[model samples]
Target: METPNRQGRRRIVVGITGASGAIYGIRLLRLLRGLDVESHLVMSRSAHLTLNCETELRPADIHALADVVHANGDIGAAIASGSFHADGMIIAPCSIKTLSEIASGVTSSLMSRAADVMLKERRRLVLMVRETPLHAGHLRSMATVTDIGAIVYPPVPAFYARPASLEDMVDYSLGRVLDLFGLEASLAGRWSGVAAKRNPGDAAHVA
Candidate 1:
């Protein structure tokens, strides 16, 4: 059975790597806040640049959405240590650069350090690799990370959710990531499977 405090609210770590899809991290923060989950965020330098180019919101605004925001340079922060317990860590829009670093056990930045801690502590680590056209090196890195118990989740939207807008798509993707950590949220449209037949006439015979 899960502990009451642990089930009541999840402590999730959100890391935004140097990838093009900054919206994923931003949408995750918004949804996590709405769900009353405690979120810790770490944004890479390249992620900050992408945020400036892609979204109108500044880093401060994004930081405000999270319960705790840590500098990417702060390697000594509590989050970098395994003693600081958390439900999981999500590296949304994880770039190939960051993925390679984590795969190779390089803890140069706080985001990477937190991921290292998660791996060492046997905590959930979800890497949302956002690159297109994967190469052999990328596949090898993904395999290496998966072998070490890290999940390689690509930002693939589900059409079954019937997403009407970009926000809906973002929510669906982030919701799936949260599901890995056993956190519940209504970010995505609930899956009800295929609709029931309207009538007997709707049924067709196959030859």
Candidate 2:
């Protein structure tokens, strides 16, 4: 379907790279579908390998979740242009390789190109970098991106939410990331700060 290009409905560019948490990108798309937002998706080749190993969904199934899917090599895609008018871009499970490319302004793939566009345009760029034991180079790249006004959001589980299952954790992360766009996903666990005032036997679940 053609995008409406209508006012009020925001558009977000979603990029999935070769990282451990492809679920973050997938869940983000699912959440976007429920909100008044349009998602344009792009995935690196390594992302496909990771998705196959980490998720049950097939490529087509994954592509179906987004309003538009741009090829990773398609640097000429609409999202590559600053005039595309997207609200922002999110790179959930952003790989170190992709991060480096964007930090260096290499634009090796559509993911990096779109992210570069977002940064140059002074648009919101949130990256859920998925890595552990970050080294000096990783730290430097993160700082570089941050210097350029990109949000280096690592998808750490919020144990304070008292999640019941894996989905709950994933949804909570997605909701919080969506918040960066100033879009609210009500599924996220909110802290009321008055939990102790509740009944001793209360099993208050975060919504």
Candidate 3:
């Protein structure tokens, strides 16, 4: 990680939606905790269901990982306002529905509302989109957010890490996203590229 967050605490807003890769969001929260970064979490209703279906973690367990938690409907939460300073916001395993809502500036949920705040405040907003085989509309929506300074980071696995387990792949993806925030949350085995397997690849070669 380079350059401490301009603001204090290096606070981050995390949104977990109803996407297949619930583990990405979970792992992100864990990494943030380990890195001692402040995290504000907001989850969609469907995320609860998926959390149960995908992993052993319960709602309380996930909530415990974050320093602050906001309801999906509570648009009035502190994070929803641009006045509330944060390093950035990340929607790990960002569902297509959630992505669309933010892209359209709908702000239908607090998740999107907080993301909207990131955009209007000119703060980084990273969306780890979980879907595959994107269509034209998906691409357009991604382009829309990108046009507005948001990053559409899909959770594609990086094999260079030589992950021996599923968790390794998840951490690798989360680490890459965290790079956008300049946070050192990568799991062991970063590709230095000097050897391409030492300290992890630089951002330019990360893709």
List RMSD in Å for every model shown.
Answer: 3.0, 6.1, 7.2
| Worst 10-residue lDDT window, candidate 1 | 1-10
Clashing residue pairs, backbone N/CA/C < 3 A, model 2: none
Q: Which residue ranges in model 1 land beyond 4 Å of their true spot?
A: 1-8, 195-207
lDDT of 3 by residue, 151-182 (tens): 99988877767889998888888888887888
- How do the residues 119-157 of candidate 2 rate in per-residue lDDT, one tens digit apiece? 998889999999999999999999999998899999888
Which of 1 and 2 is the better model by TM-score?
2
Error of 1 at 24 (Å): 0.7
lDDT of each: 0.87, 0.88, 0.87
Off by over 4 Å in 2: 1-4, 194-207
Candidate 3 contains a number of clashing pairs equal to 5
Q: At residue 188, what lDDT does model 2 achieve?
A: 63
Span of ten consecutive residues with least summed lDDT in model 3: 1-10
Task: List where candidate 3 sits over 4 angstroms from the true fold.
Answer: 1-7, 194-207
Q: Residue 152, candidate 2: how far off, in angstroms?
A: 0.6
Residue-level error in angstroms, candidate 1, position 202: 12
lDDT of 2 at 168: 90
